[model samples]
Target chain A: MSLTYGAIGWNRQKKIYDLVLACGIVLYLSLFIGLGAWLNPGATVETLLIRGFGTCALLLLHIVLIIGPLCRIDARFLPLLYNRRHLGVTTFIMGLAHAGLAIFQFHALGDLNPFVSLLVSNTRFFSLPDFPFQQLGFGALVILFLMASTSHDFWLANLSAPVWKRLHMSVYAAYALLIAHVTLGVLQAETNPLLAAALGAGLASVISLHLVSGSREVRADSHSSLSSFDGAGEFVDVCSVDEIAEKRARIVTLAGERVAVFKYDGKISVLSNVCQHQNGPLGEGRIVDGCVTCPWHGFQYLPDSGASPPPFIERVPTFRVKVDGGRVLVNPRPLPPGTRVEPARIDANASG
Target chain B: MITFAKWKLAIFGIYLVIGAVFAVVFLAIGIARVDPAAKGSPIGFRLLIFPGVVALWPYLLSRWIGGEHAPRTERNSHRDGSGGADQ
Candidate 1:
C-alpha cells in the first residue's frame, strides 16, 4: 500500500488499534502482576513480572494464531486480521522481556556468558522430569524473533510473499515448541490440574478452528472444481449473475486457480482471487469506492485493470469473462497481471 | 549456572564474530544492493531487519554475491500451474 518504506505505515485506524492494544497489554500485565503478588506473597516482584509477561505473551500469541482461521470462518473477524503484525511484534517483545529477566536472574551472575549458560546449564533433555525446557523456550523465542524482525512489508517485498509466508508459517512450530516449553517447564513443577486443562483447551481450540476452516476451504475448492469446471480452452460456466450480490464476488476455480467474478454497476469483472498484499482472499472482499478492496488489509485494485489506483502499484491477474442467459462464464486462463479486460455488461432485464 | 564446554564456547565465539562482521557490511553496503526498496529506507527500518539479516547472513550473502533480487512473483497454485504472469 506504500510506495516507500518507513518504520511503520501508521494511519488513523492503526493509531487507534495500537492505542487499544497498548492499553489492553498494560491492563493485563498490571492485573496479572497484582494478582500474582497477592496469591504468592513469597514470590519476588521480578518473578511475578517474568510470569506475567510470559503468560501475557502466550495469550497474545494465541490471539494472533486464532485471528487467521477466525477470519476465514467468518469475515466479521477481518478487522482483527488487519493489524495482526503489531500484535505479533508485541508478543515477541513480551517474550524477549521475559527471557531477559529470566536470564539476568538465573544465568547472568555466573562466570559463563548468559546465552552460553542457557544452552549448557541444562543437559537433561532425555529425562522428562528435568527436561531443558528453557532451551525449548529459547528455540521458540528465536523463531519468534525472526518473525518479528521481518514482520514489516519491507521484508515481505524483499522475501517475496511465498517465501515470506513459508518463513512466517513457522509460527506453528514456535507454538508447538512453546507448548512443550510450558508443559515441560512449568507444568512439571506446578501440579495444578487447572493449568494443564487450560493448556489443553488452548491447543484444542486452535486445532479445532484450523480444522473447521480448512475443511470449509477444501469443500469450497472441491465444489468449484466439480460444479464449474469445463475442459481447457473453454469458458467455464460459473454461476448466475444474481448469485453474486452487487459489489461482491462469486469465487470460482478455473484451470486450478481461483478467480473472483464480481457484479457491480450492471457489469461483471473477473479477477484472480489472490490479493497482491498477503495473498488475502479477494473474493471475500467487497467493492469499495468502485475498486475491489481486499478484506484483509484494505488493499484496493481497479476491477477493470486489476491494478491499484494511481500512486499505488500493486496488481493482480485479470480474466476474460462474459454473461449469457444470465449465467456467468469465465475463460479458465489468467491474463498477465494488470492486464485490462473489459467487464461484461449485465442485461438489466435478464439480470432481473 | 554450569561451566561452559570448550566446543560450545568456540561455536558461540565464531557465531558472534561472524555476526558482528556481517552486521557492519550488510548495513553499509549489502541491503540496498540486494533490495531496491531498502535503498534510502529509514535507519529504523534497517535496524529492524538487522537481526534477521545477521541470522540469515549466509543465505543473504549468496543472494548478494549472485546479484539476485527476489522479484515479487505472486506465486499461487494456479499461477504456477497455469504459467501465469511473471512466473
Candidate 2:
C-alpha cells in the first residue's frame, strides 16, 4: 500500500486503484462464500483441486487474449490491460494447481509415479495422425511458463530489450497453440460444441481483427510501393542530407511496399515500413540513440543492419539507397533475400 | 454520466463473477459428498475427484464482462492499434 503510482493523464491510475480494490473485495467475497468448498465428481480433495485449477487456467488464457483487442477497440477497456499480468499469472498458478492435483488424482491413484504420468500421458507428437490436444495446452503451458517467468523487467533488462521482445513474440505462437488446444482438446475431447464454437468465435474475433488490421498494413505497404517513384535495379532514392532531421525517418514506397528510410548520424538506412510486431507503422516511429525504436512494443531495429540488437534473432529487409542531384532515391531492388546489412556508406558520411 | 458501454461491461463483470464463483463452488461441493474439514467443519470424508467448476469460472466471467462490452468505435486504425498497447 506504500507504493504510489504517480498521475498519468487525468489521474487515471487513482481511479483504477479504487476500481481494482472494489473488484478485489468482490473477488474475496465470491471466492469465500460463493465459491464454497471444493467438490469432486468422484469427490476427493485431490480431484476437486485439480479440476478447480484446470478450469481457472483455461479461463485465464481466454481472458488474457481477449483483453488486448478489447482495449484497442475501445479506450475505456484500457483498465483491463493494467491488471492483465495479474490475470495471466493467476492462470498459471491455477494451471499449476490443476496439473499438481491431476498428478495426484489420475496418476497417483495407487502406486503410479508422478513424473512418469506427465510425459507418458497420451502425448500425440504429430498432427498428421490425430493431434494431441492435451499436449497442445502443454505446449501453451510451456510458453506461458516462459512468458510468466520472464514478465518482470529484471529478466527483460538482463535479456536486453531486443532479446526480450523476441522472446515475447513467441506469445503469438503460444496463442496459436492454445487455439489448437481448445479446438482439438476442449472441443474434441469434451465434445462441448457450444463452448467450442464460442471459444472458436472468440479467438476468431481476435484473429479476424488482426487479419483485417494486418492486411491494411500489408496493403499500405503494397500501396506505398505502387504509388511512389520506382527505383528498381541500380537507381536509388537515398534522402538528401537536408531532408532528414535527427531522429526522424521518411517512408519510401518501392515496388508496392512501405519501407521507412532513416537518416541518422549522416547515414541513410532503410527498414521495412511495416513493423513485424503488430504491424506498427515504421514511418510514425522515431530513432532513439542511433537505433530506430518502434513506438509500439518498444521494438528497436538497427537502421544499419535491420537486425535487432544482439541476443535477438529477428530481422527486417533492408535496401540500398543513393542521393541523386538534391533528390533522394532508393533502389527498388532489395538486397538478396534474408540479407542482413550493417552500416552502408553514404556520400555525406564519407565526406564527413 | 457514464457511457452505456462502460455501464454494460461493469454489470457484466459483476454478474459474471457472481455466476462463475457460484457455479464453480456448486460443482466442487454439490456432486460428491467429500468433506475436508481438517480446519473447522469435520474430518470425515477424504476422497478426491476433479471438480470442473473452477475452470469455467473465468470464461463465464469474460463472456459476461467482455461479452457485453459493446463494440464502441468503428475507426479503421482502431482495428490495427487496439488500445491494448497504449498503456
Candidate 3:
C-alpha cells in the first residue's frame, strides 16, 4: 500500500519471507540433485538439474494453488497468502530454468532454431504413446510468464483488479497444462507407482480443498437469504450485535453482496468485505489502532469512512447500518467508496 | 513439418517486433502521460513493468490513446449495486 509504486514494496516481513524462500529452494535442489546422482550413476548433471528445477516448480505451484483455499478454511493461513506472489514468481523462474536446460540439451545442437526445432521435432499429436508433451509444458510456461511479469501492483492498478484477477485466474489453465505435461512426458517412461500416486494425491487435494471452501461460501449465501428481512427488504437482519466481537467483524451476505459489520468502541460500522489490495477478505481481519487492518497485507481502512489513513488512498464501499433489538440490520445497497456514515451506537445494557 | 513451425515463428516474430517498439515508446513518452504515479518513477520501476508492457502493449496503447489517464476503480457486485466502484 504505497502512494508511489516501486519495483517492490519490500519490508521486514517480505525480506524474511524471501530469505526463507531462497533457503528452501537451495535446500530442496541440493537434496534432489544429490539423491538423483546417488541413485542414477549414469545420469548427467544437466539431467539432474532439469528434473530438480521442474519438480521444485511443480511443488511450488501446488502450494501456491492451495494457499487461497487454505486461507479460506482458516484465518491462521493468512501469512502464507501474504507472500504468495513472491512464491509464484519464483515458481516461474524455476520453470524457466528447467525449460532452458531441456531446450539446450535437446534442441540447441540442431541446425534449425531451437524453438522451431522444439515445435517441429515431435509431430505425434494423435498418438498417446508418442505425444508432444513438451508443447503442453511450453503453453504452461507462456501463461506463467504472463502472470509473473504482471505480478506487481502496477499491473493490478492498470488492469483494474477484476481484469487483473481474471488474467491471473488463468493459472488454473497453466496448472492443468503442467499436469498433462508431466503425465505424458515423465509418467510414460517411469514405472514408478509412487510418483503416479503422489500426482493423483496432489490433484485430489487441490480439487477437494477448492470444493470445500466454495461450498462453505455457497452455504453462507443461502443462510443469508433464508434469514429474516426487515423494512420491506431494504434492510437485512445479518446478525446480533453480540455475534461480532470487539474490533472484529461478522460477515454477512446481503443482496448478493458480502458485507462486513464490525463492532468497535460501542459502535458498529458496516463495510464491503473486499479489500482494495488483492480483494482480500476484510471481514476476516480485526481492527488495529481503530482501523480495519486487512489480514492479507495489513492495508488499513477507517471503519466509518472505508478510507485508508492519510497518505494512502485505498478505499472500500461503506454500508448503511442500523441497530434494532440487539440485532444489526444493514442496507444491502452500498454507498460510494470512502463515503462516511455515522456508526450505529451499541447500547451496553441491551441483551444481544 | 517445417511449415507449421515457420508459421508459429512468424507470429512470434511479429509480436516481439511490435512489442520491442512499443516498450521503448511507452517507457520514454507514453507511460507518464497515462499514469501520474509513474511520472517520475525510477529506472528500476520502469524495468520492472517492461515485460508486462511488452506483452500487453495493445491493451495499454488503447488505454493511453483513449485518454484514460487515471487508474480505474474496480467494479464489483456491491459497487455496481451502489452505482460506484472500489479502489
Largest DockQ belongs to which candidate?
Answer: 3
Interface RMSD, one decimal, each candidate: 3.2, 23.5, 2.3
For model 1 the TM-score comes to 0.93
Which candidate has the top score in TM-score? 3
- Give one digit per residue, the lDDT tens place, for model 3 in A243-272: 999999998876567888999999999999
DockQ of 3: 0.64
> lDDT (CA) for every model shown?
0.86, 0.54, 0.90
Error of 1 at A107 (Å): 1.7
Q: State TM-scores per candidate.
A: 0.93, 0.44, 0.96
Best by lDDT: 3
Clashing pairs in 1: none
Which is better, 2 or 3, measured by lDDT? 3
For residues A1-352, what per-residue lDDT tens digits would candidate 2 score against the true structure? 0011111212466467446645753464345333435321344555445544565566567667766656545546655665565566566666666666665666677543444454455556665345646556667776776676655432333334566568777877877886776666546545547776767677777777666655665665554453345445455544565676666787656644567777776566776665544455566578987678765445577787666676554445666666555455666655532255554445644442
lDDT-better candidate, 1 vs 2: 1
Model 1: residues >4 Å from true position, as ranges? A226-233, A348-352, B1-6
CA deviation > 4 Å runs, candidate 3: A231-234, A348-352, B85-87
lDDT of 1: 0.86
Model 1 / residue A126 / CA error / Å? 1.7
lDDT of 2 by residue, B3-85 (tens): 44356556756865775565545334432222111113211111111112232344323433443322121112222222212
Residue A341 CA error for candidate 3 (Å)? 0.9
